[model samples]
Target: DGSGFLAIFIIGMFVGNQNTRKVSYILPVGEGITWLAQISLFLMLGLLVSPHNMVHYVVPGTIVAVVMTFLARPAAVLLCLLPMYFRRYSIKDLLFMSFVGLRGSVPIVLAMYPVMDDISNAQLYFNMAFVVVIFSLLVQGACILPVAKFFNVYAPASVAPISKANVGIMLNDDFDLFNYKIKRDSMEGRRLRTLQFPKETAVVAMFRDGHLMKPQGGTQLKKDDILSVIGVESDEIALNAIFSQDKPVKQYPLYAGDKIYDGHTPMTLLAETYNFELTSFEKTLTVAECMSYHLGGFPQPGDFMNLINARLVVVSLEGDYIAKVGLYLLSEIRLKEHRRKNARSGVSTLSKYGQKSLHR
Candidate 1:
């Protein structure tokens, strides 16, 4: 029986440590089964107990209770825990542990075994077990917290959990989950590929447009989307910056001869008008490779792509793909115009000074 119990415990530990992704999905069923079994066991034991017979063994039951609480439980804890260096239980902790060893109605069930076997003195033993359980439950169980506090072994209350996704398993302290609501204009229409997330961070799931979505690299995050982010403790700053709800700006079509924009003109036209060179590039790579201002791969609309001293905006998309990109040389044009204006002013000043000298 002991070997079989040990084998079952080992199997349980092995199964618990394996890939537990399915645990969240199957928790309701497992919890229901456990609750059902416990309820059935207690209900069966409740039917077998007789309250009138319990009073006969009160004196012997109290003696057994005192010995079990003060001697047996503490001795078991010291013998089992003190020898193991890894589980160094302090005196105060052991005191609290011993105080909380309340043998509830479980002993009552065990005492029934002798009665069922037609053993002599079974009635007396059962009554004693019942009285001991009542004393333990009414006294030790009630004073557990006070005993912990008196020993200074009570732990502080932990921070409340933010996620509603509850499975019965405890998570490792190394990992944590963060919840963020992508506010309007913040992360709106931005693809996951464009964002440079940290190595240890991952967007496990997202809620968008009233639907749950398992996001991938190419997935575009919309405004008001609730993201379920998982990351290590050290990556909190990076995660907050990525999910920040900054105000949105109007994205215009940055192209040549575009009538919609009043002040901002096309890059090529601006360059021609201002007499500056407009550099360009043609290449194709995965969206994952592309960044905020690069042209080696397909980029999202309104994203700036840079080249040799020129810039381009991804003006359009071809059904989840980049179709056309608008080129610009605005900075170069402004620089050239400023230099020309300075030269013209210098020349005008020289001409005026020469005319004045002639008059003098």
Candidate 2:
């Protein structure tokens, strides 16, 4: 990457072929879209506000919002959405976005400024805004799920839809994310670990129905569970091939280990073999796969003293170990001493962590 600046000559269009690079396109796209949305908002708001009879139409205003949310929204939902229903903004999605027009942090303060100025009908404006917000949230938020079900727009596990990808890493390394829809009756009741996985592969994450799963060896992949797979460079093509194989497994997987992962990947191998616990707390743990180039090596322990005996464990940078290992070793020693001294008092907390690790 010494020549990182050299790669800028190619147009962005060619680079967006990959998800990680595609985001470079998306961020600007999103900003432009946001800017456009803001511009449209100002224009529309300026056109819609009729202060002359504002107070006189408070009731009608509320009624308009209700009608818009309940009638106009569902109408738009069934029309623009149903034709290409991959995961149609379910009733919940619409309900949340439609009615939950948030005033946000700034809006609350700004709405109050008019009151401080004591502008005529300022209180009414603020109060109306507050009331509309509350109604949108209360009435709309409450019915999100129900309306989703009613419209059959609610996300179902059976559909096994592919969702948008907003994951993976760029730790001075390449992270390619892939998504695939499992076919019906193809390979249900089967575990993915036993399958033919790609070389240099690392499946760091998996998602299902808006939930993040901590995947494991026995985590059987099911139909409709959107897989968020991350792999290094070598395996990218192989992963793409597997996802597009002649016949993808069809039967929906029944076993659910709760922990999510594609175990055939290098990530699972490293995690299961090394006893290294990857946590959300640690950001560097990201390079989704096990590439030979980035072993980056084992973690090393730094200087830390055990207060009980003031015992010391010094881990050197040598032996291909991570440099920050000693501090954790010391912490572990201290924790063990604390547990031994506290026994029953702190046993519950330590025991829980131990149990969870064992499950992993």
Candidate 3:
């Protein structure tokens, strides 16, 4: 009744909500403390367990363990995760999770309470709990890796830095410091100047084998060298590509306005950029001029002209002229409809433009 579990849980909730930035610092220390506490708990519980008494209950205890491991735990896991099946969780993943639900020191610790209270047959309860924990550790724990492999859920281990510390600088919400370790035969033997990092991102510092070094453009990167990079959140994908063993894929950042072309932009350039079909006559005109010709009147905001495989929607108006136009492929329209059906709130942006389509 006086267990500190609830109190500690409440404290953890408060700290997680209020001081998340400090949690990273607390984790390494908390992990060490947890290991020590688990060791002490098991040792104390072991002293109370009698081999002869436990042997008498082995058959029943094993039956309890078998029912819990194969039936109860799996049913509970399936029930809990059934609702999330649409979230890309396959049957194999759920099965693997069910099998690996290892019983640990908590049950034995709970069983000790009745013994301390001098309840009748409390020693039997403790013995049963110890057997369950031993069975779980020896059986489920040993099979975890094999089950993961059978489920095709095992992934190749990636090389990670020996140590990482968040700088916790509140500069810009979009920008932060990222740490990367140079992989062997990957980014190693390359100069910093040769790396094609995003223009907005830059190397701020370098650490080699636990020693701090100033990062310079001419400095050669070595295996296991840790680099502190300052970049926006979007730059992480490109950074990972650069540091990975595989050839980097070209990445382009598209802004919301990129889909909406300026009305003053040349029709020929837009046609070439998006591979839109344009007649020789239409290529000579600007986007606004072409749209106005097709409309046969003044173009206002929310006017759209259907193209071969895409639709051009007028985004905004400057006086009587089209100011901005959005291009949406037929596939994109269907995708947006699917998202709107699932999310129910994704149509706000398109709804602002009204329901006007111009067919030529």
Candidate 4:
């Protein structure tokens, strides 16, 4: 089935959806799985290539790889992204995504025959494939984010699960939360406001023994609180710094009656409440985003479709205070359930956090 292009188109839609301003964080498990699948394919194909055979075709294969990564991939991305109406994806994000286009397992498996069977100049074919793969990995992997910024698809800052040993608790088909177990006795009793992290991260919620912690500043801490946080891919470094510190996290001063809730404000302002960005901002919408939100992907509290009791109480007739509270509250509930189900099987609620709009 030439459905390969169709599948790619669909995947692009999903990836583009996650790049939107309100929802852009990818599922940690899915992201990791993609890498795993790619690697597995590569390994399977590696058995097919012999060094002598690969060396000959190396140069031509590199040319093909470069063309695929630089030209074909970017063109596909532009086709998929242009309709979404994004303004942020700069030349950089396009360039980087294009660069990282590794021809992993599928190509390897397909290449096996050329290496095994005497196709004219077998070594040349093998070598070129190797060269292409290297170019994809080295040039592209090295610059994923920088390119994201250029493409204007770089995600917002917030707490994120460690990519290496990440644990995502799927609350249901719609929502999920990524978990990182903070070592016990570290940062015990510290207010949520005290954690030191970069602007590129957010601590969405916390948990203990699988029970969700209130997404509140006053929420006290205990050993082994399983923190459920949301952040862009970049915030991982800062997240590591905060959790690794472990001691009573230094507290930031809160003025009298200071509330973290800011109404329909710039993402930068709203994001200050958590350790990361409130949502990854994309100026445009793609077909996948429309399908995911089911209401044409408007970025308002009203857009938060099913937050139940959630309300977007506008502080100044502008902010979706209701949606904000709803997200925070949902985050709390999800955190608790994740804790209860930590060692057991449970659905993940992280994906459900923002689908509800609080226009009411």
Candidate 5:
């Protein structure tokens, strides 16, 4: 009752949530202490149990371990997670969790309490607990990675930096310094400028074979090179996508002169990035869908639509679907005139060039 474990757990939860910055400073020290404590715990447990005594209980302990691993643990996981089925928990996730119910040092330590209190057959309990722990480690632990793989509950490999240093400055919360090691061969022969990173993201420093070098736009990326990048926090996803080999990178097209977007580009992204207006319902549509809707569901190359102050002209098509669109902003005088004519007409109309007016 007075073990202080519950108290420590409560304090840890409180501090972790309330003071994350302070907690980060102590993480390295806490990890070192945790490793030391685990080593000491196993050593102490090893000193208490004799291999001769453990041998007598091995058969029964193995049976108990099997039952727990195959039946009891799985049933318990199913019952607890069944209410969350489909919404938050999936069948494969539940199955994997049930299979990986590894018994740890806590049970062995609890077993010692019964023996110390002089309970009936406490030595039997201690020996059984020891055998169960050993069985769980040797059998269940060994098979965990294979089971996880079989369930497809694994993340693709990513290269983490060898070192990180936080740079403290004004408005630091909005920005971050990321150091990534280029481990994949996909980016090995590509130049830095060709990678199409996010606008606010830049690679500032590069190190090859332990020698620091300045990174230029034309510098080619090589495997095992460590690069220090500085970018805003929102650019993290785009940066990760650029570095990832297995995942497809989402394209972030610019709104500069003569730039065209693929048909698949989201209209909502365009509106938000370029200050274009869109209705709540229209926000869910893509550029191709909007253009096709304006053109009466049959769009061809060079067909244009007048959307607010910009003209969206279909540039190309992949079969019947619009594949590319070029955007051109109207002059201030033309935009005012277009709006005045729409207000006076009080009806949706099509122009001579087959351009639909979406003003109303």
Candidate 6:
């Protein structure tokens, strides 16, 4: 416990890796503490610096900033990540990682020591440190995304889970808060008392037209209304079945060459056919319309949509509408299982269909 910072780091890692219950409980408190610390640190550092005095050392400060940004930081990153050694990381990845070594409030905070001790070149060093921090925050920080994209390290688009509930409250680790928009026509216009949610799950709060109301048995739900409920994880599927507009596709009787749709199917059918549980927003829209809605206009070939548990690429287009959709399931275990099952049965199923078509 010589350094409180090191002790905190160790404790954080221990709790994060080993104690799921403790982690969930402490996460809110830890976040508040972290934000308060960050704000206080920046405020103290700002009060300690003098902008007019910094201008006098601008030349030397800028030179140091250039060296740190281009050489020193990159060298440190490459050396530390040397274990990657061309196996997993390529040159572009290394370069991008190096470019992102941003200096923050910590370095500026450290620089305050020299000024307090009245050491030689103290003011100049402080000024240079301040300059480097600004350069990192303003310049390097801004370019981080673009640079990552250039190196192909950026993640693809997907349905983002903004928050689990209207107000995330973990009561005793026995239940989790799940936020859902009332989408299914069946659930809309129904009273909370009549719907009969699971015994363990309870709707804690409801948001209607941007207003938060504590839900009671008499509360009636409508489309676009958001409900934050606390429930056990195992009961989630049952809850989703009620509130979600999307229905699970029956895996039974699905065979190769089987047409899922004989006529026009909603674009969202791609989700059901591919075994994806659609997000509340993904229901009802045709594939073409969904694409256009998401992409800001008509989606062309190569445009992709990321749903909660699935990824879709527009494989083909028929005049401004999506004709063929390619689904990429995000779960590795599920993907392998599906592939194995389909490959085993696909050959026989296709042969039967092919024989009938040939005879005709």
Best by lDDT: 5
Query: Per-residue CA lDDT of candidate 4, range 53-76, in tens?
Result: 666666677778778777887777
How much does candidate 2 score in TM-score? Answer: 0.30
The TM-score between candidate 3 and the true structure equals 0.55
Q: How accurate locally is residue 202 in candidate 5, as Cα lDDT from 0 to 100?
A: 64
Deviation from native of the Cα of residue 288 in model 5, angstroms: 49
Candidate 1 per-residue lDDT over residues 25-59, each given as its tens digit:
55568679768866776676677678777666788
After superposition, the stretches of candidate 6 with alpha carbons farther than 4 Å from their true spots are: 84-94, 165-177, 180-360
Question: How big is the positional error of residue 44 in model 4, measured in Å on the Cα after superposition?
Answer: 3.4
Give the number of the best model, judged by TM-score: 5
Candidates ranked by TM-score: 5, 3, 6, 1, 4, 2
Residue 76, model 1: Cα distance from true site in angstroms? 1.7
| Root mean square deviation (Cα) for candidate 6 | 17.2
What is the lDDT of every predicted structure here? Answer: 0.56, 0.46, 0.68, 0.49, 0.69, 0.62
**TM-score of each predicted structure versus truth:** 0.47, 0.30, 0.55, 0.40, 0.60, 0.49
TM-score-superior candidate, 2 or 4: 4
lDDT, candidate 2, at 233: 54
In candidate 6, position 296 carries an lDDT of: 46
Q: Which pairs of residues collide in candidate 1?
A: 267-328
Please give me the total number of clashing residue pairs in predicted model 6: 2
- How well is each residue in 172-267 modelled by candidate 6, as lDDT tens digits? 345667888776666655655445467677666678778665554334567787888777766677676566534332222212122323114575
lDDT of 3 by residue, 1-360 (tens): 765988997887776554345666677787899899899989988888887777788999999988887788778877787877778888888888777764786797898998999999889889888888888888878888888899999865654434445557742243557798887575655656557777677677787768676543334577888888887656777776667754533333221233878888898887777666676788888888887777544443444555544556666778768888777665667646634652332112221112222122
What is candidate 5's lDDT per residue for 18-94, written digit by digit as tens?
42334546666878987997788788778878887877888898999888877887788777777777698788998
Candidate with the larger lDDT of 1 and 4: 1
The model with the greater TM-score, 1 or 3, is 3
Query: Candidate 2 regions off by >4 Å?
Result: 1-65, 71-113, 157-229, 232-360
